[model samples]
Target: MDGKVIFIGGGPGDPELLTLKAYNVIKKADVIIYAGSLVNRDVLNCAKNDSIIKNSASMNLDEILDLMEKSVKNGKLVARVHTGDPAIYGAIGEQIEGLKEKKISFEIIPGVSSFFAAAAALETELTLPEVSQTVIITRPEGRTPKPSAEAISKLAKHQATMCIFLGVQMIEDVVNDLLTHYKPETPAAVVQKASWPDEKIVKGTLNNISNKVHEAGITKTAMIVVGDVLDTEGITPSKLYDKEFTHEYRKGQLN
Candidate 1:
């Protein structure tokens, strides 16, 4: 190949959310391939005027690789963009494997995930001193099969905070699976089109989140976060900034 391919995480939906590195890559790219159905079109505004841009939504895996291989062979810099952090459920693994077989060099650039944007939208932390210290990111099985051990019901037993991706359309089933271990009163939330102009959030308990999400008409392109982390009531304050806490930085103030 004459050039390299760069896989970029385009962030949630806001063009401003693009990292400086991602912005520069888009600006310098000679070709851009992106997920059209899920990615925000505005993110492409930074692309070079003469850049070759293609939407991968209608293309098969082989087609995507073919384009990348061709572009790289032509001595052109190609940008492969995906919404949110490309590492999480971004399906980059298969592409990486294909690249390896073809010996096409590439690099990955991480971006702000929708779960983080969802937390920002809710103005809450996913982890707290006395609340959940774990954030389990998974998706309920759909056409994409998941390991039996990683079932939503099994993950719920940890009582850790959860960031479910691509499961909003099946909210009822997800709630049912979560109910197997999580309390019905446990807080749950859904953030749709996070960071976008029409972003919407649905907050409630597991007992009612399914109905609430349906009522809000959020079917897809959303994040489902659940656990005690969503509830900040009576949580112990973090000790990092507490005067009573001691660390390598300072001594505890004790009289």
Candidate 2:
């Protein structure tokens, strides 16, 4: 009996935000390994009563791989779950590499990322025509160094909407770096544990966001959104929805 591993994105702390495929896989998994610190425990409700569940929070890469390898050899279907989309900051690349080296079969299922959830919670669009055409998803340089070309200050030069991950703990530095390019009054917002029941949102300008976040006591598990898109006062509506615009799906009404 050949076994396999499925990497499921748990979707930003909201169990409902999980993809249907992920839910099904969790339900059918013979063994489930999840990121206990970040993933919502409620998601475990989908698993069988007798399923073997392990929390990877305290486990290192080798220990995790050992568990996966042992489970696979025993012909058990394993579900390796991570918070938000596995592709983003979930640190699954190392795990995937280990699996490949061991000749283990695996598949990655996508899920709703925290940034999108944070955007939805704020009821703001990350991109608005003529305002911002690009969204930069990045984090401040911490223990893990970022490429010089992708540094926050460098990226801020475009003044594009930025959704920063793993930087809330360094909000002051993040704000300072962003200020190098963005204006002092540039709109910024932080959403902590987006989509969770007790989620918190703090909105302010680049000059004051750090203070606001500090007041709110948001140290981690937060997304920092910056740019003019948060300004709902003067945004231009998308042309795609304009009644006069023509496209492959619609003909121009005015000509």
Model 2, total clashes: 0
TM-score of structure candidate 1: 0.98
Model 1, range 16-74, lDDT digits (tens) per residue? 99999999999999999998988898999989899999999999999999999999999
Candidate 1 backbone overlaps, count: 0
Error of 1 at 72 (Å): 0.5
Clashing pairs in model 2, backbone N/Cα/C closer than 3 A:
none
TM-score on alpha carbons, each prediction: 0.98, 0.98
Against the true structure, candidate 2 reaches a TM-score of 0.98
Error of 1 at 94 (Å): 1.1
Mark the 10 consecutive residues where model 2 has the least summed lDDT. 232-241
With candidate 2 superimposed using the best TM-score fit, by how many Å does residue 123's alpha carbon deviate from the native? 0.3
